[model samples]
Target: MHVIAERLIDDGVLEREFTLGEIPGVLWTPPSASASAPAPVILLGHPGGLNGMYPRLAGRARQCAANGFAAATIELPGSGDRPRSVDAEQARADLRRAVAAGEPVDGEIVDRLVLPLVEKAVPEWRTTLDALLSLPEIGGPVGYSGGVIAIGVRLALVEPRIAAAGLFAGSFVPRATFDEARQVTIPLHVLLQWDDEGNDRQMALDLFDAFGSEEKTLHANMGGHTGVPRFAGDDAARFFVRHLR
Candidate 1:
């Protein structure tokens, strides 16, 4: 895998370093020029433990780019490019508050900071979608893949443009997450492993049951938390092409 640390922005689709208050993040985009045609766009959310550019995720992003899709992988507030550690009690308190409020809690405690970063991210992704649609080379569909951030599946369901999604060893926080996940109406493809440490098989089963969409497919592999070694990357690419396109 090739790693390059640089700010990225293309046309109206901007991929640059951004900060949500004190939290720093990286953004991505498609071409900016407007045209008659529109292409699909995907906003990728990375796994919790790994950085955005983890080998598996990097491979997936490259595959998306090679397959004529605009894919952007962004690091979560507390992970990669931005790291801050809090006491266990503080962390538990924040998690509790987020559970109570039904949203992501990032940053210092007591402030109850609920950044609308994902909400804001939707428009940025839409801008890239518009740019992609304008391009003559892309005439197919658009979608998203939560490389490890399966929680984004719930978010994608609320958005109108996300036609499909691919999630690998996804993490769904709090029990209420399944309730939000049930609202998803698009095709959702989940890849889970039996021995995975991050997410258990039962969670995947529950998510499968919670999904309201009739077009859901679940694949259980032999690998552990990371599904890469167990499942072939080519198979994943095929699955994306089969559903997203």
Candidate 2:
């Protein structure tokens, strides 16, 4: 991990833009934080890509800092410094066909378009965590939030370091996602935009229902994907506090 730049954002949050190998990203540390007393950290994921970092994920990072935690986000694969793999379009076509046909996508299709990325992404996140927690400004009791829903599902199933998670469930879910969700027993707070134009409503509900976390919550709001009320962010912040603090 290497630091690219560090600066203060609105209300005095310290935003440290950095890279893990080739991954371009930023880390936000709360104001008045102690290097000696490391603060808890959150891994903030995004729906679109790294371009979603500023103002959205960036704002979330600042919020985490204000609520007394450090937060960081890495650019997902096929986003930012990473370009889409050769099979990306084929995978999309395969998925569209499967969804249209109302059948499970073939395992090879999953391996090509979706699972490979998930496989690559999960490790990068773990590696990033390896480097992130080592920084004196970041401490334990880590949490994960935001999504490319698949990544959130996979990490929740796998990464034990994340003490809690707040997942945005407004994206397509693979058939295997529920299987993964069923293994995630950590405290989870999922945000759902009820009428998202681009999402399959039943899939979101089903994925939430499949989660093994007895503490999981589905925070459904009556809105399109982007219609989430501002206060919902506060509610999620409180959820993190309840679990992490």
Candidate 3:
């Protein structure tokens, strides 16, 4: 598909920080000459442990833009160029407090700190969705994807405007957050590697079964944790076309 990279500014929506105080994301759309009467939109979430401007996620955004959809990829709080200003010691203290309070810690220190940030950022995602839907360029359905960006999907469910969703390498959803996925009614597509480190094949199967939507699918790629099926490239494009249209 045709692809181009461009920046978007405050066309109409205000540029603001997420609740977790992350860098701002610009809204993207098709150029006026090439866009349809109304276009679909996708809100892309980047994977954890990488700069917010991860190439794969950005590639997907460009792909979506080329395929006639308005796509927005937001940098989560404390990631990308705006690394978390919170000191390591202070972050450790927050984790200690959370653990002492009987919050789930699961042997992963990052989760302890990131969960709270995800919690705070959920409402910001909601507001972003509202703003996206309000744009005249976005008229079709909405979709979401991130290798580990399912946390954003959990938050996106709070808004009814989202019509479909896709998750890549999303292995964990805390028990408290499990209810969020269970409540969504739209179609869901999950892409997972056969040997993903974070989420195993069985876990992906379990999540697919748990989804409330009758129209849910799980796709397995032969690649390892990061290697996805080449089909994924096309699957994602078609997934948007089938549902967003």
Name the candidate that leads on lDDT.
2
How many clashing residue pairs appear in each of the predictions shown? Answer: 10, 0, 0
State which candidate has the highest TM-score.
2
lDDT per residue, candidate 3, 1-245, as tens digits? 11133444333222222322344565566654122476777877665433435556556766676677777656565566656647534665765676578775453555555566676556766777776666566675777766444475575477577788887655454444455667767887778788765554665676667678778777777767667765786787788788887
Off by over 4 Å in 3: 1-22, 32-36, 48-52, 83-114, 147-150
Model 1 — which ten-residue stretch has the worst lDDT? 109-118
Instruction: Give the better candidate number (2 or 3) by TM-score.
Output: 2
- For model 2, residues 1-245, the per-residue Cα lDDT tens digits are 89989888888888888888889888988875678878899999885467755788887888898888989888877765587776776787887888788785565675566676787888999999999988877888989998778888898878888899999987677778878889999999999998986577887888889999989888988889878888999999999999888
Q: Report the Cα lDDT for residue 192, model 1.
A: 70
For each candidate, what is the lDDT?
0.54, 0.84, 0.62
Tens-digit lDDT track of model 1 for 1-245: 12244444323343344433433433333453124433345556664333536555545555665554555544554445455435433555666777578664443432222223333444544555454445454444666776433346545666576778776654434455567678888877777777775444676788778887778777776766655552455565666777665
- List pairs with backbone clashes in candidate 1: 8-15, 12-32, 15-27, 37-133, 37-134, 38-133, 39-132, 39-133, 40-142, 196-225
TM-scores for the candidates? 0.63, 0.91, 0.74
Pitting candidate 1 against candidate 2, the one with the higher TM-score is 2
Q: In model 3, what lDDT does residue 92 have? A: 59
Candidate 2's C-alpha runs over 4 A off are 93-112
